[model samples]
Target chain A: MKWFEYQMEVDQLHASDALKARLLAMQPDSQTSRDHSAPAQRGRAIRFPHWRRWAAGAAACAAVAVVGSQVLLGMGPAGAGISTMSMTAGGAASSTAAAYDAAAPEAAAYSLAENGLSARSAAGADSAVAGEKIIYTARLTLETKDYDAARAALEQALAAAGGWMENSSESPYDNRRSLSMTLRVPADSYEAFLAAAGETASVVNRSEQADDVTAQYTDVAGRIANLEGQRDRLRELQAGADTLADLLDIEAQLSDVQYQLESWQGQLDWYDDQIASCTVTVDLREVETYTPTGETFLERLGAAFAEGWQNFVLGLAAVAVALAGLWPVVLLVAAAAVAAALVLRRRRRR
Target chain B: MWRVSQEELYRIAVENYSDSVYRAAAHHCTNPIDAEDVVQDVYEKLLRRKGSFSSEEHLKAWLLRVAINRCHDLSRAASQKDVPLEETMPAPPAADHSVLDAVRALPEQYRNAIYLHYFEGYTAAEIGRLLGAPTNTVLSWLHRGRALLHTMLQEEIEDEMV
Candidate 1:
């Protein structure tokens, strides 16, 4: 038989009607029936097996449990560790105090020796050297009944103490007149200037601070000495160079050493400027009556309530914005729910 | 996309595609019982599918692809016991038994390609897409299947004449 004849014969082949009817009568399995209850469930069922999904969920939960346990283990000993650290810190503090006490007499002797040594140094010979570098600053906030008399008295006191006004501002507002000035004085006269300035006005607040920069000054001095020594050695090497390359190499080393020396010199100059002058900020206010600026308890409570209400409104607006962004998703879910309900209702009618 | 309810869609799919799926599965499975199982499985897959078909042709193509895959899975199952094809397969009508037997005697791949091409009237390209093979491979299978069928049927005819 020809190919077309064979094709025609095979095309006539089919299953019996009884067998087709039997297959048509078959219903889905129990698991499939449960899946058919919801469209989302049906989609999930086709995606993966139930056991695989359960295994994935279990793995995720196990990971979370592991991480949580690790966090708990880390935090559990933190309290004990803090107490232990505090005890160690206290022990270190006592030891430091003992060491400071033992070294007190030696420190005094060293200061005297350093004063003698600095008197002979080039920078110290030009200006009187203190035993240690200290930047003294004082802030005096005063209330005065007579603004002009207090200001004149302060200027006289500043001149007598060998101090100059670095900055001065006078403000006349409403009924009050205030004068604020920053004064720079010789370090040796800082105490005398402060005492005299205190006498010129009724001192309401007085604060003095002394920052000792002896250690920083000594460190910079040592670095400068080291760099100078290197520069001298490079100069000797440059004098003895036999070849052009050797001379060039020595010159580069000398240039680098010189640059470092200049940088250290600049830092030393800044330290000298700070140490030579003591800064004093004096605020003299002319007051007709004394009025406190501190807020009462009732005022604080009212402010807190206002802040809380503002935060609540901001939270509500944030939620409204988030809901607006998700409107499309919300609409899709609503449509799905309605379709599911219709399917369920039709099944009931059937 | 289908606008009908899921139940109505399912009924329509079964009414339209059940016989064709069963016939194709019977060609592969050899046994009527296994073929029916395959038919049921294919329908179950269809019912659970989340997507809707673009057209009736698309739905038919999906059903045929799924039916072929189910038949392949059944054939490869470790627990499957080989039943004698002559005993388990229902005899075709007396006029067509010889030709049917000859067609069934071809190798599994050629038998599937031949059945899809000749019996279902699918082109080689369509059969290749359904079977997840290249079109040229389906064409080769068809050539070999036809050669084998012609030889087998001719020998049977010669024997009957003798």
Candidate 2:
């Protein structure tokens, strides 16, 4: 009744010689037959035909050609006509002055042309603000004796500077009474707001950054204009389509172009919003007593050790939860290792 | 890049591994015809795979895994009906009938474990990896399978004596 003896018995039972020969005789050509039949069954599930794809591609290329011509024409002397519709400096100058009177003298001479947008300074008269769209951001960390009073003062400062809080959070832990807020203010008031915020609490840290996004914004705007022209051309083609297949093909192109236009339009709107407002991050914390900046080396070492122990316990808990989730797989692997070791040991003994 | 033509590679694979794949499929399938279908399916998949094997052992393991999966798929197919083993296969010679019948009558999982462990000489862990079961589960299958086979064979011998 030994398993090895029974293994011998079963090993003797195999496919008949005829079946073995037949299986071995199978050729790779059988796959060709299956492949040929598979497409026929799959064709019903396919939405687009070969000819339809080619037709759609051709229509797209034609629309692109039309849009390309329009962009080229607009960039030439005829571009003045396109610029006149959106870039009347007189109206923009007045609006800019009304928005922020402090920067009015600089905005009065701003102009938009084929190259890009630029601003001319009145006092220097020779100096010109280069054609660059700059987004400004400021980070301010403050320490105050009263967290609530500091937070209230910061909100009032934002309102006075024509800014709105974009996001805000208060720490839930009792040991650390802190408030964090992100505010969006008119670009002209960015420095003024930072100065006002400094009055609310003692400034512990301050950082300012300016990012140039002129090229990206201009590229997205140009793409949106091109896609809009393409959509219009596709609509015209749809009107001229005579056959059902031609109509469907044109409609598909129209749908695709419209989707692209909407996506680029969203990007343009985002750029406009970002360019109009500067971001200011404020961090306020309550400090009971003012402590000197200097600390002993031993004190720093003790703090480091405490932080390390906390992280170690947190890491151990994470590992325990992960292992609990994969217990079945763990058991299988453990059993496999034990079985493999036993098999190797038995082989050696023999 | 493969130096050999696809046709040449297909020929070499069939010549080298077709019998082993067919035997594995036959152990699980209800009849020879179904087993043949599983064999064809496995070979077809092998031909269509885009990746090249690292070595001969890798190729053999791939073929066995695919053959086992194809057998499972064929057995589970709702359109497939069980055919009598005698109808699909010619009667075994008198000497091998007792053992063949007993092996074939065992449950599918136990039969696969026994065939792979003993006939193929695979260790329990290797069989576990192939069947996607724990090593202990495979060992349990082998143990219960042997106990069942011993009882069946012993009963047959006693009947013959009677």
For candidate 2, give the lDDT of residue B29: 66
Prediction 2: B-chain TM-score: 0.75
Chain A accuracy as TM-score for every candidate: 0.46, 0.46
**Candidate of highest TM-score:** 2
Q: Model 1, residue A282: what's the lDDT?
A: 96
What overall lDDT goes with each candidate model? 0.66, 0.65
- Weakest 10 consecutive residues, lDDT, candidate 1 chain A? A37-46
Q: What is the per-residue lDDT of model 1 for residues A1-350, given as tens digits with 9 covering 90 to 100?
A: 44455555545656567755655565655322321111211111111126778999999999888656544543334334334445544544443333223224344334334333332232332223345565556787877878889999999988988889999999997457998999998877777887798888766556555554565677788788889999999999999999999999999999999999999999999888877888889999986522221146455334344434444455577888898999999899999999999999999656
Q: Model 2, range B1-162, lDDT digits (tens) per residue? A: 445666666666677777778778877665677777677777778767767866665677778878876655544442234454432222332354465566666766777777777667778887887777778788888877766766656533211110
In the order shown, what is each candidate's alpha-carbon RMSD?
A: 21.9, 30.3
| Candidate 2 lDDT for residue B93 | 28
Model 1, runs deviating above 4 Å: A2-24, A27-350, B1-4, B78-97, B155-162
List DockQ for all candidates. 0.11, 0.08
